[model samples]
Target: MHGSFPRLDIGPLSEYREDHFMIARFSDYVHEHQSLVFPHRHSFYHLVLFTEGSGRHTIDFHHFQAEPDQIYFMIPGQVHTWDFEAGMEGYVVNFSDSFFTSFLLQPEYLDTFSFFDQDSSNNVLKISENVRERIGQLFEELLAQNARATHWRDDMVRVLLLQIFLIIEQSDAVDRRKSAAKGKNATVRNFIRLIDKHYDKVRLPGQYADMLNVTPNHLNALCKEHMGMQAGELIRNRIVLEAKRLLINLDLTVSEIAYRLNFNDNSYFTKFFRKETGMTPEDFRKSPAI
Candidate 1:
């Protein structure tokens, strides 16, 4: 609860400090990097596949119970921590944001996966028992390839990781395919990326619409159709989520947080937070995490 005003951004484990990629058994990773048990952020993309575990993990204040065959993906900069029973074992992979960009000509290729969309609720998935063994085999291959330095090692690792992503994507392909059929999947994803990049300064749907080269109404329609919410609501939700994340850092005063979020003043920020979450900033800060 108390440390830096902003949470710490942990780099790779000490053993692989200079490398931009790492793979390990979950138990080994946890044992080697105990600091992760505390509230912190990561500077690299992270994913974990659990073969055995019980308890829960929190990503950006959202709680998810730990379970076998359940996998989770996290992009850089999200807060994460976990509490699990003894004997938790699985596979974990950490790679730089550029891990796939250079390999694939399409820079946004990874974005097409719904789990990497920066929404905490969508980042966790349960693996159907049918494909569980295949997924485990892929992880085994990733681990083995990572251990060797012979012949295109990095490329081999990248391909294996993509295979894993493709398998998981198939599980949710129906919903994603439906969104793609709507013919606005790319546009909506762009809008979301823009919001993530500019939410602090841009507050209006019109601003985002202008950036996206579409009318505000068109933008709203796309969001409503694909995301089940108006464009403005999406922006507000991102802002509020950031607020909640910042409030978790006990070292930061409310006024400091307000400034960080670019609110005009402390009072206005409090009002905005209260309006969106139905709780004052202080109240939320003091509340116990689920």
Candidate 2:
């Protein structure tokens, strides 16, 4: 039987302090973790722009060929693992949502980034060679500013990060336009955003339908059309994902995770976990591999 997936709480390579919001790297991270980066999910967002590489990147069980000038974005809870040849080079930026939301004037601005698409379908953006030079500079500055703390280092890095996002948005405008269904898919996007926000306390498709001001049937239809899954399935998937993250990374017990995720009883949570993952929570925790 298939078992549970384990999340690497500490980054496979490195991490800043818990309270700190972000970290960026150019080539050092890949060089340090020369071995396999175990299949793991992060609690923070991960953005990578590879300038040189040849191999594969596995995201949510899908293998994407590794290519230079390609960028990959992963939000929380998506499982990823990568393998590459000896001399791959890239820039990686890891951030917590609170990092920008707490400081930026527009707290909800992140929702507009096409790459962070909740369903993770368009997460990889292939960049052109012309734009690579400028993008690489942005990463350079972020690395320089983060190297040593000055009076305004954090603020400087924050501003630079915003610039990087804008550049990517501008560069990817054509791609977004190609698949853009702003009028129709907007509702589905809103539903996914809501699922990310409330999956723990609200799991019913009807609840999400009400939030979107559409009938449950309509909502399910839209989800199937856009995501190839029902709205309810997405909600349950999010909840189970968070549960798995907490179970594998934290010191919390099963009962504590059950309550944290709004399940009233441990038994029901166990049943739900088993139904979704094919293994009991205890068995999952004990497994040597994901």
Candidate 2 lDDT, tens digit per residue, 35-73? 436567777788888888588777664578888888888
Worst 10 residues of 1 by lDDT: 173-182
Local distance difference test, candidate 1: 0.83
Give the C-alpha lDDT of model 2: 0.74
Candidate number achieving the greatest TM-score relative to the actual structure: 1
Residue 69 in model 1: lDDT: 86
- Candidate RMSDs in order: 2.5, 5.2
lDDT of each: 0.83, 0.74
lDDT of 1 by residue, 1-290 (tens): 44423454555453343476899999998898776676677767889998987878999888999998889999877888888889899999988877777799989788777778567877888887777888999999999999898889999999999998888777642256443533348889889889889999999999988988999999999988888899999999999988887787777889999998899999999999999989999999767662
TM-score of 2: 0.70
TM-score of 1: 0.92
For model 1, what is the alpha-carbon lDDT of residue 242? 83
For model 1, the stretches where C-alpha displacement exceeds 4 angstroms are 1-8, 11-18, 172-184
TM-scores, all candidates, are: 0.92, 0.70
